[model samples]
Target: MKKLFLTLFLLSGLLVTASCNNDNKKDKKETETVEKETVEVKEEKVVKTPTIVGVAAANENFTTLVAAVKAAGLVETLNGDGPFTVFAPVNDAFAKLPEGTVDGLLKPESKETLTAVLTYHVVSGKFMAADVVKAISDGGGTFTITTVQGGTLTASLDGDSVILTDAKGGKSKVILTDVSASNGVIHAIDTVVMP
Candidate 1:
């Protein structure tokens, strides 16, 4: 009777230990699943969209424009809470200007002129490509946009592309449009539009 009781006790203890081990495995799996979900949520939250200035600064194609904006002291202004619409000119667009023109504009004494030039590229409100096209269609195939610098830019269509005619009667074609930013939008042009 003693031997039988001891054997029974040992078997019960082993069974209980085996059951606890199984429960531990289940708990571990649950913990691992929760941790995996937490990590996934964290990864999703890490992606952040930059502002207009930040976007331009991050892009290699906008290096010249970014440098000009910085030289003009418009970085802080552009980064403000404005829904500005910018007709951003790329590096090649800046190259289209006469030689030494960009260097001359970057001078400290040229801050006023540079500011004017930069501001001319920006409109006060956000105007997406669709809105611009619709406005052009409504205004007898041409839309006049008033710039932040108090200049006017004429918008018209040419083979489905938006063409901007600046104050100097120079033309720049919009190569890309609807680049979203935190405070504004950027429409890339093929040539620099002057005020």
Candidate 2:
């Protein structure tokens, strides 16, 4: 009788231990499944929608503006963490310039001029068209914006549209308004005015 009682107790203990082990395995599996789900969510975020510097980068019209940005060694900077707003000018806009002027400026010797012109079109922080329009309507007299080049661009409201008059009195009309990008905004201009 004593031997039988010992055997029963041993068997019960073994069964309990085996059951606990199985429960632990189930718990581990559940945790692993949750971990895998979390990993999948993170992987989804890793797929980035590539944003060109601004709408200008995507715009077929702003070929001149794109070329100038490339020439000024500003592609990376514009692509960097800017909430920049660009007054992007098109190829036809550049053609409106004085004869031989665009070509002269594109040369390596005229980098300073090219850089100034390019940066003049940019506002350092992102400004949505609505905000800019509102600002223009307000009594600020001058809505001053700092450029990527550390200079200021002044905006004034003329009738319905915003008139951006650079430091040198060069003016551009905002044709395409409020194009948003990951880094900035782009406003298409009809003419490539100089600064």
Candidate 3:
């Protein structure tokens, strides 16, 4: 009787241990699966921000500006991690120039001039419309900023609009204000500002 009771007890204990081990393995697998699912969910929620070049490329009005930037070899510079302020010109702005001017600038020989003109539209730091307006107000209604092309641009308010004066006395009105980008801000102009 004692031997039979001991044998029965040992078998029951082994069976219970085996059952617990199987449950533990199942629980571990479930935990791993849940963790993987969580990681996948996090990845799916991530959002990508558009850069200055990306913003220009996406908009129809900035197609000419985008082409000019590419021709000037400034795509990488604008795509860099900078807080630049760009005064972007619309297609009509380019049309405001004399005939054949755009075609001439797009040529390889005029790369330097094209670069200078494009960089002239960019400032080193980001300046939104409100910041520009405040600067204008603080500076006796006119604000002077240095461009990346080693030229100075004057900003002043005309009614509710901001006017940009170029080095060659050309005036460009900011028709669209505060187009935000990952690396900078863009202000669309009706006329191309010359360096």
- Model 2 residue pairs with clashes: 83-126
Question: What's the lDDT for candidate 2?
Answer: 0.78
**Which prediction has more favorable TM-score, 2 or 3?**
3
Off by over 4 Å in 3: 1-37
Clashes of each: 0, 1, 0
- Model 2: runs farther than 4 Å from truth? 1-49, 52-54, 140-142
Quote each prediction's TM-score: 0.83, 0.70, 0.82
Candidate 2 lDDT, tens digit per residue, 1-195? 999999999999999999999999999999999999999988885545344465566667877777888887888878888777788887888988899988888889888889988887777778888888777668466577777667776778777777777767787777778777878778888777555
Error of 1 at 85 (Å): 1.7
* Cα misplacement distance, residue 69 of candidate 2 (Å): 1.0
lDDT of 3 by residue, 1-195 (tens): 999999999999999999999999999999999999999988896567799999999999999999999999999999999999999999999999999999999999999999999999999999999999999999999999999999999999999999999988999999998899999899999999998
Over the stretch 11-117, how does candidate 1's per-residue lDDT look in tens digits?
A: 99999999999999999999999999999988885656677899999999999999999999999999999989999999999999999999999999999999999
RMSD of each: 2.7, 4.2, 3.0
Name the 10 consecutive residues with the lowest summed lDDT in model 1: 42-51
Instruction: Give the candidates in order of TM-score, highest first.
Output: 1, 3, 2
Worst 10 residues of 3 by lDDT: 41-50
For model 1, what is the alpha-carbon lDDT of residue 115?
94
Cα RMSD, model 3: 3.0
